[model samples]
Target chain A: MQTVQTIITDLKDKPGALLPILHAVQNSLGYVPPEIVPTIAKALNLSRAEVHGVISFYHYFRDHAPGKKTVRICRAESCLAMGGKALESQIKTKLGIDYHETTEDGNYSLEAVYCLGNCACSPAIQIDNDVYGRVTAESFNEILTEQSA
Target chain B: MSITVYVPCDSSAVSLGANRVANAITQEAEKRGVEINVVRNGSRGMYWLEPMVEVATDNGRIAYGAVKTGDVASLFDANFLNGGTHALNLGLTEEIPYLKKQQRLTFARVGITDPVSVEDYVAHDGYRGLKNALSYSQAEIVKHVSDSGLRGRGGAAFPTGIKWNTVLNTPSEQKYIICNADEGDSGTFSDRMIMEGDPLVLIEGMTIAGLAVGATQGYIYLRIEYPHALEILNAAIANATAANYLGENIQGSGKTFHLEVRQGAGAYVCGEETALMESLEGKRGLVRFKPPLPAISGLFGKPTVVNNVISLASVPVILDKGGEFYRDFGMGRSRGTLPLQLAGNLKHAGLVELAFGATLREVLYDFGGGSATGKPIRAVQVGGPLGSYLPESQFDTPLDYEAFAAIWAVLGHGGIVAFDETVDMAQMAKYSMEFCVEESCGKCTPCRIGSTRGYEVMDEIVNKRDLDKNIPLLRSLCDTMLNGSLCAMGGMTPYPVLSALNHFPEDFGIKAA
Candidate 1:
């Protein structure tokens, strides 16, 4: 992990650096640890409450370490209209963990996203950056296997 | 010479397979041993004819739409590069009736310009507003906005000038300008479209706001769902900063306006101004009590001017052409053009930025071309999930803030979602409550607990419970939520529920009293 000093020193002077730092950290180290909030707060001259508030407000910023592969199930209205609930349940059963939880083997992390804007192909899920549309419970296993390897 | 063809790859266009079509065009050109430049531009929001491909020639750009991968070989053979007519003929891209009819002030250069290139943005009247604004006093700029009659496009139609004026009056050493781009509504994708297609316009608009309000920093609270939009914006910001359009001494004017994009967690409540402010400050997106308006004490408790993406996006046009030019376009108090998002079961689901007072029938039948399934139009949910479901009879109602308010309806975000006869109003009404329950922040009592209870009451009434008592109970609960609750999320949740109860009484298996 990059030290807090390095992260702070790099980001502090740049205007609107907090969000960029959060995004960079999340991109580099799967999640933003709570321990680094104070370092960000002190560096940016913001209170820890303020820094912590922003981190928690967005669902994209995860505090906990994700599994090796992360799958974001679409829960947007269009997806929901097309049996996303059943699809979500099926993934949960297969993984043995609920939404926002990681599997025991550290192979999969499941979370819900509002929309991937792939409504035409309804029931979409993004396994990392690649979006798979018209996803089914049966196909999810195949997709997961592909990612796991 | 390399033959250049432009196709849309913005999310909406991509959803329709523009990339596949682009690849096919590239392959066909390659097979012919002809060099090609397939530049992926953004959509003009003529969505029905998506995967729209524009071929550049000496004559200008000619558009062909609904083009498939298989059609590429034929397209290339027809001398499309030389502007020869083909069976997939779309005439001139600008002359398309859907594109021609729209008064796209805020979304002016979206489809026509290259998104990533700063030089292309400048060629199409971009950053002219900031350049024009630098000459005027901040007060003069605020006065110009006051005359434009531009209102917040993010649900509440608050005047932008007054908000800027409030921030201007405040004696603060530091202030901030925040663009609320957390467009969480199911049917509204206009914000995402604007961000992807014309990111520089938004950057320019925010910079103008920053200059006017004496604020040095701006943040666009974009929803996390829009990864593509965020990527486009980040690159656009860096490009702008590199060109001295942003950062210290913008355009060498000695005025600084720096901006950044803040990705929001998938919380619906954060769309509210106060909740959005809380989220910006890095707090849980719970709505705060008013009295301290965001203009007086907002993000980081400094005087802040928070405006919607459309509201700020409209500013550049107002500044350049003068406010009266924009003020002249609309009818009544709802001045200037509105980028109405036509979605759901419509034949033409796209963006139409028209002046206020265009009748709903014109928007539905004329613009939307009726339902996609060729079924009878049952209801159109204007404004989003929280908006009321207007029945067929209300088609005569004009699209204006006052006219909508007359029927207890709001033209929220101008997202008109058409539903066919197949759509069950009861199910949709149930989903409204369910959505509120799912997305509710749980800070207030009526919204937090009431939405869950409302869902149960709705289920009971629809299933087996005594209809007479449950109906009244539902209305009473709606009233409680409308009167109570901190933000519009809970307060406006009852609009869809009540509208369905009033308009589609048959869906509930209850006879009108």
Candidate 2:
């Protein structure tokens, strides 16, 4: 666990420190803990509402805990054109959880992204940072297998 | 004291191994005990002969192209440092036909200077706009921008000057300026290129926006996918801040402004203004109702000006050269150059910032050189995936906002994705609705529920089950979604589906005998 001082001291004086601190905390602890809000508020000379408002402003900041493995599917226009919807439905059925919902076994957290800009090979998904393009429903099973293992 | 070597850092150049080529030159120069200044610059956007490098000479910058890491030794032997020519021709970097033909006002410094160097930016007349803007009243600045005929480059052609004017008119204790860099459009990398190639211009543009609107705080909503761009921008912001270009009492003007970058999780809907604002507030990517347009009550319910990266980035030039000078380059209501992103199956996939009146044929044939696969170009999808698929007959169409809208299409983000004859329009059509269903924020009924049903109905048409009923159903569904959705995610969802249904009915089994 990172001390509140470490997080605040690391970014307090910077010009655009809010998002970076939020990203840093999330990277270190998987989520931006509510505990840091007060610390960030004090360190940046902001109110808790101000800090929390900044935290909640961007979509990337997560407050809840994530499952062990993350599965992100590209549902952007190009991906959808290439059978992404069917693939998404198949994945949900296989995982038995809808988007933004964690699996019962804590194995996966599924979410959809707009465009990965990997449209050259349509119907793409990002398993962590690695992009898999032209992916089908059949290829999705292998992703779960890796997570299951 | 300075020995200059150019590193062509354009996206196409990177795709064609310019990074490796640049690295090799760096390492070889180190080995030979040559004191060299390596500057990574933006692409000239003439992509066919990419990996194009430039070396500064007494006469002018000399150009070299199609260079690889392996070609470094020959380049060294050819005495490139002293301006000797190799097989990769050289006359003057400025005189290249493709580059020379372009009336580059917005992209004047692109591919010419080091993106990270403030010295290079200043040498190329950077910050002149900000400097000029500093002397003007906020209202005067906004008036100048309004007169320039600048509109939002993200998608909708909202007048930029009007937006700034609104934020200025709104009597708020706290106002905001946000640069929407969530460039989620496929086949479009102008946002990436501009950030990587000329970051200071964007900074300058944003600063001008901040100054124009009496806002002390600003945020750049950047996408997470652009890690490299984020890094470059963060560095530039830091340098600017240290030099007092950003943050408290900028350049001792007694006026204050602070800017920060907010990295977005990969959400497509977040590109929408309200959704972007919501995401910036750290909620689920959901669209907000308009009327209290972002100009009135945006970004924490303060008077906010949300402009796209290109729109904000174009401000400096509009200020420095005068709005009239910047406005003179484009045709009609579209009064400025657009950073056209030519991508997908095209032979020349790169950034081309040209005037609005340029025809599709000129871009596809004259600039893009047709299909990369060497197959006959069948159709092109201008604007991102949400744009309608225009057949060859529409090739005569010019790429202006009104011109494109007149033809039942939109040049969203100026991304042109070319497809060869091999592409199936039916599958593509199905994918469009399917895409909307997947990315829809579920905030509105038309987008969330209608898109899913539209997909099913589209599938029914292609599968030839109750074909007549389903075709009309899909059309009606598209119509409802278009009118009802809060944002274009649901609104523009109809473009691909409707275009496919209209143009390729045979593919949907209507004419298939």
Candidate 3:
């Protein structure tokens, strides 16, 4: 298996390469493990503090491994005006987990994102890599059930 | 002749099942042995009509919209290829009143042509600006942009030509042109649309900026949220490079320019130029105090021209047509068209590229067809999350920058998110403060600590705990955040909070005292 250090080394030479390296690491390793920060810092020739700061600053970068599936719901004003809060409540009730929590079954992780830029459709959600808009409570449940099944 | 069919590959369209609709149409066409050319065009900005399928007809392109996979077979059966009549048919795409009435200077070819095809882009008069730009000296190019009265469309409303002249005058061996595509603003998708629908225009615009400022290196700072745009832009860049529109020695001008796309780690503050530069340098996204403006000293401590996607995308037309012709549109200081995004609970939520001075009521009613829920529109948040929430009484305000400023509201990024009567203004106000607390970079105290305090005070007011005291306290905190913050993220957050409090006092459980 290619180590996270190898990934960092390949991308380190490029200009403004840290974010891409972190994204690549998370993409390959599922999450950016805390132990690899020093290696990334070394590869990019920066302090571990700087590397860690970048990781913690952005909401998208994850430090820990996610569940089998990730569900990101839009919590911006457009979605909020379109019943996103109620949809969020419904998800919490159904999954028995709050925002940023994974289901006990190891099947799902719920996250609150600011905006997915689908305000025209409103009430947008992304399950894994696929985005869905105009999502309702019934449709949300159906999607989750299908993914679990 | 093979029928030409267009289905948008725009992310918003894809999110609403444009991809599925495309797939269904393709598969069904194959099944029926029908000869058709499926062109993946960018969105027309009329998002309500998406998965808007356009068929090329002699009478002009006929549009069928809100198409689903299930409807594809029926569409094929109804002979939609011949502009067949159907429940979803909306006649000729150009004749659609929502689209016909507005001026689309920046987004002229957005939904009309295939985004990735350089040939298609050029056919629609795409790279004429860069071609025209190569013939002129850097000073002339700067003069043209300056005379056009073009300002940064990314909310600040700074003159684009002045910014270009600063970079042009600054003696830097290595200057940069950075296109800010962070677009963290809610209810705004014009940037994403331009990037996805007509990426070449953005590329061409950036190229023009490179030539105009004598800058050889450019970077487009994109947000991580826009995965689709990232793909389209990368592909378009490679295509433009291969075609010699990008990279060194463009059209044998002996001038060199290289462009790259850098992904931003989901920070709203990164939308600010200084913060964007910091993030681009692979550092923590923190706003730097300005004295050395980005145009004078920016991006690796060199002169840089940082512009929003719309501002940069609007450049090609300004170059192709004379700057004076482009300047002829709109009223006052706000010269040129603004791509207004009609979102939220509007019945016909979409993109409307109109000149300045169109009344907000016309946008909400004529183009948007009012609230989607058929309820009265109690409030509309013009601009993004940080924009002020205007009451129904303020709906007639003109869309000009100065007009909005006169009423203490900003036409930031021209994003209008309407809300029906069911919206709770107090809750919305609290969310603004809470949003500030969550997204604050912690560089300034007024934004970091003040926002949290504001959130707490809002909670007290909303929960009806010491309403009179907390309301006044909230106002004072908003004032501090408004005056003392380092950037707009902190400074403008009070726009939404105070606007909500002042406009909808009843929702906050306050009877004007």
**Interface RMSD of the candidates, in order:** 3.6, 5.2, 1.0
Off by over 4 Å in 3: A145-149
lDDT string, candidate 2, B54-137, tens digits: 888898888887787888988888888877879986568888766776667667888887777787889999999998899999
Whose lDDT is higher: candidate 1's or candidate 2's? Answer: 1
* Location of the lowest summed lDDT over 10 successive residues in candidate 3 chain B: B504-513
Q: In CAPRI terms, where does candidate 2 land?
A: incorrect
Which 10-residue window in model 1 chain B sums to the lowest lDDT? B9-18
- TM per candidate, chain B: 0.98, 0.96, 0.99
lDDT of 3 by residue, B406-485 (tens): 98899999999999999999999999989998899889999999989988998888899988788889888889989999
> What shift in Å separates residue B398 of candidate 2 from its native position after superposition?
1.3
For model 1, the local distance difference test gives: 0.84
DockQ of each: 0.29, 0.18, 0.79
User: Candidate 3 vs. truth: CA RMSD?
Assistant: 1.2
- Point out the worst 10-residue segment of candidate 1 chain A by lDDT: A114-123
Best by TM-score: 3
Assess each prediction's global lDDT (C-alpha) against the native: 0.84, 0.79, 0.91
Q: What is the DockQ ranking, best to worst? A: 3, 1, 2
Chain A TM-scores in order? 0.92, 0.91, 0.94
Candidate 1's docking class is acceptable
Which window of 10 residues has the lowest lDDT sum in candidate 3 chain A?
A1-10
Q: Model 3, A79-119: lDDT tens per residue?
A: 98888899889878988999889999888899988888899
Complex DockQ, candidate 3: 0.79
